[model samples]
Target: MSLEIRIAAPEDAFAACTVLRRSITECCVADHKDDPAILGAWLGNKTPQTVASWFESPTNYSLVALKDGAVIGVSLLTGAGKLALCYLLPEARGLGAGKAMLAKVEETACNWGVKAVQLHSTATGEEFFASQGYVRSGHVRSPYGVDTIFFWKQLDRGAAPDTSQRKRFCNCNSA
Candidate 1:
């Protein structure tokens, strides 16, 4: 199967949301521990409309990973260089889709001239993020009742776009 990663469109919200929910419910058992209260709160705002709004937000860059034209993974990066979300269908976890999406997120962060990228990783995702060069920074109890691991990666700003040449429209360092 071929995997493709691209900017997410509003129309992809449903499929992306599905992937997000499934990934959390199935793959994140270590984090939520099958606790209905934690899962419910964590997934409360993951609706299609919310996902569509995320795709449309000027401060966010959203991406979807497609496997043979089906959305199998989704990710979002903020202008401030936070990886707000990254999820993949359980069946798609071992594939390279997650890595591709992360590369794209880092590329976009560099384009925005971000110095670092941060994320709160679930228990299931800690090793994956660590393998991708993220350093564990701290730990926190999420509002949804899950214990989360914080990770950050300092980007190579040398490859970032020159701020002098482009109009600063985001809250990133370029601005």
Candidate 2:
């Protein structure tokens, strides 16, 4: 099915929570190993109420990807250039949805007067982040024991540098 990307509203919290929980449970099992404690801790704050809180935050920029009027994915960015969340259901993987969501996040960052974005990714998501121009900056063990890869990507503003009215500070020695 074709997908649509848009700013997330408060009403979308429940659907966004569903997508986030499923993506974590099914798509992240390889990293979390189905450990209830780990998964529970990782997903503890992903309830619909928290999702609504994200929408309510003035410093947050949240987006949701929809298919056939249902939320299939969610992306969230903090005003401070942090990519807080990006999740999609199992069926949505490998279909460019994640990349699209990330692009929108970058756009939001630039609009918010930022030069780059950063995120802490799960081990399973490391390759995907790298493929999208994000570089590995660090790694750490989460409280749940899952390995996390930190990433940062430069945002392109699509404007060529203008050197028409420039200053000349270099002096050339006579040959």
Q: Which candidate number would show the highest TM-score if scored against the true structure?
A: 1
What candidate 2 gets wrong by more than 4 Å, as runs, is 156-175
Per-residue accuracy of model 2 over 1-175 as CA lDDT, tens digit each: 8788999999999999999999999999888999999998999999999999998899999999988788899999998999989999888888777888898889879888787798889988889999988999999787767999989987864766569888766756423
Off by over 4 Å in 1: 157-175
All models: lDDT?
0.94, 0.89
RMSD for each model, in Å, please? 7.0, 5.5
lDDT minimum window of 10 residues, candidate 2: 166-175
- 1-175, model 1: which lDDT tens digit per residue? 9889999999999999999899999999989999999999999999999999999999999999999999999999999999999999999988999999999999899889888999999989999999999999999888999999999998984565557777667777843
Q: In model 2, what are the clashing residue pairs, if there are any?
A: none
